[model samples]
Target: MTAPQSPIGAHVPVAGGLATGGLKYAAEIGAEAIQVFVANPRGWALPEGKPAEDAKLLARTDVPVYVHAPYLVNFGSPSEETLAKSIATVRHSLVRGRAIGARGVVVHTGSAVSQSYDAAMAQIHDHVLPLLEEIPDDGPDLLLEPMAGQGKMLCAKVQDLGPFFERLEHHPKLGVCFDTCHAFAAGHDLAAPGGVKDAMDALVATVGEGRLKLVHANDSKDVCGSAKDRHENIGAGRIGEQPFADLFRHPAVAGVPFIIETPGRAPEPHAKDITTLKSLRAD
Candidate 1:
């Protein structure tokens, strides 16, 4: 089968009783791509299932697939135990990602805990680089997702990711997952006129277009630069509709997937959001 027109998808349910069922549901809902967690979103336990068959089913689907690492993973942690577990989890995710034919694996650029900023950066460089080095080229590359400008967050802004790229020595496989809500919350005026274009230009300048792998299409519940992480439905929150249109129409993201992480009580609620995004694509 031919690949879908674009990598436009939503973060459909993949936890609890919805694991495999969610993937099928997403495909049925016209997703060209999809993101799911292989295991519990909060816990550290690895997922238990049949990989070969799951991989076969996922591969036969029309859309590309991606896996989001658990929220508890903090690769930048100063604690040795936490760092070790984080590395293991990342490695496991990469292995599973390859087995499932996933295009990429997503992990948050975590915090430095209560440690000094410099110390935290040092720890990240010393510890995280080696872990990333272990990932084979055949496996999926890790996508560093920046969070809101929260306390002790390692990557609070798009520019703050410079050190991360530097620490990795600008590894070709290391890419970025730019989240709309996070960017807006971190002081990028994505809602204002020229804001979306300016932010995209800044990102291209900082990391270059080649490393721009994924886009997290989320709307913020709080105002821009509020440092909040709340996600609202598309065009219903601080990001508004025009910025999203600009974002989807940008040439940099032409073929990239735009995964929706917005709130929706039912699949029907996502219809409007998906339609809005689809309309932004060029004819």
Candidate 2:
């Protein structure tokens, strides 16, 4: 498929009523793409039910839509029940995403949940490998989102993904969603001069450009390597705007949708942020 010329978008709300309203809001705000939770973000409950009409609304919308999986899923959890639920949730997300014509399903890189590093790694391989094979080729690409270096999180940085990819044997359908705030909190230094470019280069070297599927664009409330996942509005936090401008212009991430996960100041803040990022795109 041809890549988009500009990939700026926002995270529209999916809390009340049908999700069709979210897509309508996104398009009305002039977004070229959008992200939404298929269900409650913090819960593991499988989608209670599917709304064909809602899916139809998404299909008719002009912008691309992506599904952000619930936060409770820890694919690398030491508990067998948690791991099983995580895998099931991922599959359910794929089905829901495909039904809504979403291009990708985003899941956090997840934590080891207090286990030793080796055991965590082993559990990931043992559990995830077989599960991945069950995913159909037509399903939305699984976009792994690296979290901040908090707690026992795996894939703490761009470099940390190498081992996971190696363990998965470099599955072609596997891709990554780079979150700007999280990257900064993981100590990539995007706020420093030339830091954004360097971080992008490091990501390209580690996972290559093809696997870089999406970006979560947000300014950070925490300092670099703070291991906190707090997000602030663009240009309103420590990350600043310069790095985001650099990131917006980078060829490596050009066509990948940059979904804003920042807090809104008002009803139209989402639209304003989309405009700001769109203006930053390389001409």
Candidate 3:
């Protein structure tokens, strides 16, 4: 049988329940897949997972679901308490992910904050290894998303993830979520000749193709090497529309889902952006 088309979707809100709010949002936006926050993104409070509601969402096998770990999670935090909390939160996120049958859980590579990169990597090694060790057989893949080359952030660029993969012994459960805006912000110029392809090649070299799990399909508000994380709409941003064609055509991401994390949460704008992305795929 032929593989289904690569899904193009957006970050959807999970206000009511994963089935009701997030599922409805995906349908409204014409998304074939979606990403949602399992708990409060800005806070440390871990809420109960609604498996009954999630069952309803999962019954619709046409839509693949991905979970975005809370933004406050920093596995490399200088504070021991914060590092512990980050580990606990990631563990909880994976539990919820398993309950909901999510494809993967996305977490930021995060910052070291007043610590050297070596020190930060050590902290991450200490915290994340147990996570890799204890992932339930049915748990969702843990995906690491590199940042916009911000201060002391681990995995600030694609190349920075090599040591991390090595530390994990290239665990099968570990994966990656590449964000276009972050790539541009970190100095990978999709607009330059041979740039997007070169970047994808480098990513494959660093993380291997199987671990490339998802794409946060976004446009950047800032120019290349700015190290800012501002996201723009599909065709309106500095990255523009043409470069996305290159991204869609790249072999590294051949079957990966592209989930828009652009500015608007409303369905109309997201639908338009998804349409733009689908059109680019055929170009």
Candidate 4:
């Protein structure tokens, strides 16, 4: 199998193993970079390490690998038990990611629940900053991905991200994984004419270009500002193909990997989506 020409890929499954299943599937779909869930995404299970398998996967290609932290991670959760678990889970994800030589570990910027946004941010800062400070220079970056703009969601809009960054003192290890669908759900309107570029501009202004690391390239099943997180296949949702072309041409995304998180049961749809996006790349 040939490696992708651009740093674009899909969130491939790790049902078998990273070396044997996930990386192989990535190659089959022409992915140059890939994202995988190292542990059960719905649980707080700490990932088991297979050093030999990790070595094999790491040695197979120069393609980048990333880890998506479990959905149960909610650093902002008001419940003390849940909060502690969230911190532990994120820390464990980082450990696993570093073992596999992943470039970054992505976690959702979670909800405030019944707490006020300020209170939630305070809790997040208390728990997250120490973790960030502990990261060795060689370890993978902890990428904060904004969630759908649901009730009391922290970092729901690009503007909401500023305070969190400030709390972390703009630590270099703290990076961002920009999700297109979530951004749209947060009311960024990325599908409208010139909307993609405008959104990129806002990101650069808010986080600076350097902190923007990965892209969760997806189409929204819901309309802009709907606060829903449903994802659709490329060009098959409310966010059509044109915005993706704009995405390809945007200078901010240059050298950044666009990892597709769209719905599909097989590799064919992913392959097609990757090809379509590649065809639209300007350079």
Candidate 5:
């Protein structure tokens, strides 16, 4: 039997319909895995997924599915209403993720808009703790994606996760979705020698093993440490192609899926990126 390698793909479009467009695109791009939004990515409203659409996605055993929660979910918000909606949004995403047989649901480690980081973290412990407790054993993991170190971001670098996991009591259902563009933006200097290895080592040392569940394989549009979240194509940005090959060789990435959220119009650019990532990981 062949050993399982990390499946490389992209965040596909679900505009036409979940199964109709997303799955069709996945097939066209030869994606082994994919990520989609359960609802409008900018809205807070919780919409029930179509059972027929859900069934079609669930039946897809060859393609592993993941969900990216709405962009508005900010647990670090100073507003009570926003906090409530954030929790609810995550809950809804988890339910929808399970309905579609998703392995994980990615959410941002949001900003501390108008408050102290300490106060924000306290509120996070008070509110998000119970939310984390609500996750069932069989449910899809809630994958926390660190930001690009812009503004008052709560979590950006790998080390920032230590405090978060400590506060959440290291919930078993909690996992990470590492974004290469964000890491490069946050200044891991992945373009430098041993950068990928050092960062992976630090992640394991802090979070221990198995918390790394997914990867967003994107190139950076800005220079390292610039705190910009712009994403370019696989090898056509500040983060050259060599670092991705380094990522593939890391032990922490075993069985993790690399889903590109890069700039593209779709089928062609991402398909080309998927091919590039496959070639980098190939033996």
Candidate 6:
């Protein structure tokens, strides 16, 4: 589903506990869906969820959930230790995701630091393909969210996804988690006329249909093509608001859920964003 046409939610806090805090925050924001960190977002440690909390969240079928793998996960890393840790961390996310009945798990498509892009891509192929193969029929899809066109980053522009699918051989379970600010920062120029449509069309053409499973509804603090990942509140950034309205009208994401990763403490700002997305809907 598209923005207004689909579920609009946010990345809720899991501090109080998965169900205790995440679900409570989701309720406070009027979210129809949510994304969360199964473990620490910045670390490599994989912690098991509380069984009762897992059961509690798993029972709430109304609010669909998603898991974001830790930031340290980078399949393209040249370090063997980092590579192994990345795979294990992602696999952990997949297992945790299924335990909580999550629809998908989002992982950042990472960089090729200090090496050739081809070599880095090879590393991804060597590692990620097998990981993709491990997904059970009932398990969640692995959603790759391309980064801002920052330093050695792979898969920034929509066009960059072509090789990703080709390398994975278009695995049945692989999907995309498109991020608005990231795209804008990657030079998609989404604020211009027909820009959103152009980028979406490019996405479908690059990966084929139905691969876009999620949207990170964010605005950028930096100018277009700046390659900065800073996220601003909706309508308060350089990308403006029209592109998002156009995003809701795009057919490629017709039923995909949109989740905000914007700046906020909780509740109030996220609630306002959910309202903004609802208003952007074609009523």
Clashes of each: 1, 0, 0, 0, 0, 4
lDDT tens digits, residue span 173-254, model 4: 9999999999999999998888999988888888887787898889999999999999988889899888887887777777
The TM-score values for the models, in the order shown, are 0.93, 0.93, 0.96, 0.95, 0.97, 0.96
What lDDT does model 5 reach? 0.90
Model 2, backbone clash pairs (residues 3+ apart or across chains), number: 0
Give lDDT per model, in order. Answer: 0.80, 0.81, 0.87, 0.86, 0.90, 0.90
Q: Lowest summed lDDT over 10 consecutive residues: which window, candidate 2?
A: 14-23
TM-score attained by model 1:
0.93
Cα distance off (Å), candidate 4, residue 10: 0.7
Residue 169 in model 6: lDDT: 93
Model 1 Cα shift for residue 163 (angstroms): 0.6
lDDT by residue for model 3 over 191-283, one digit each (tens)? 788888988999999988778899999999999999999999998998999888888877778789999998875877889999999999876
Error of 1 at 60 (Å): 1.5
| Clash tally for model 6 | 4
RMSD of 2: 2.2
> Candidate 2 residues 1-283, lDDT tens each?
5444756888787655335457667776777788877777777788655657667776665677788988888877888888888888888887888777778899998888778777887877877777667667876788889999988899878999888888777787788999999999999999999998998899889987689899999999999999899999878899987788898777787678889987866447777777777776753
Q: For candidate 5, write residues 179-244 as lDDT tens digits.
A: 999999998999999999999999999898999999999999899999999999999999999999
Clashing pairs in 6: 1-254, 1-255, 1-256, 2-254
lDDT of 6 at 217: 96
Worst 10 residues of 6 by lDDT: 1-10
Candidate 5: residue pairs that collide: none
Question: What lDDT is obtained when candidate 2 is compared to the true structure?
Answer: 0.81
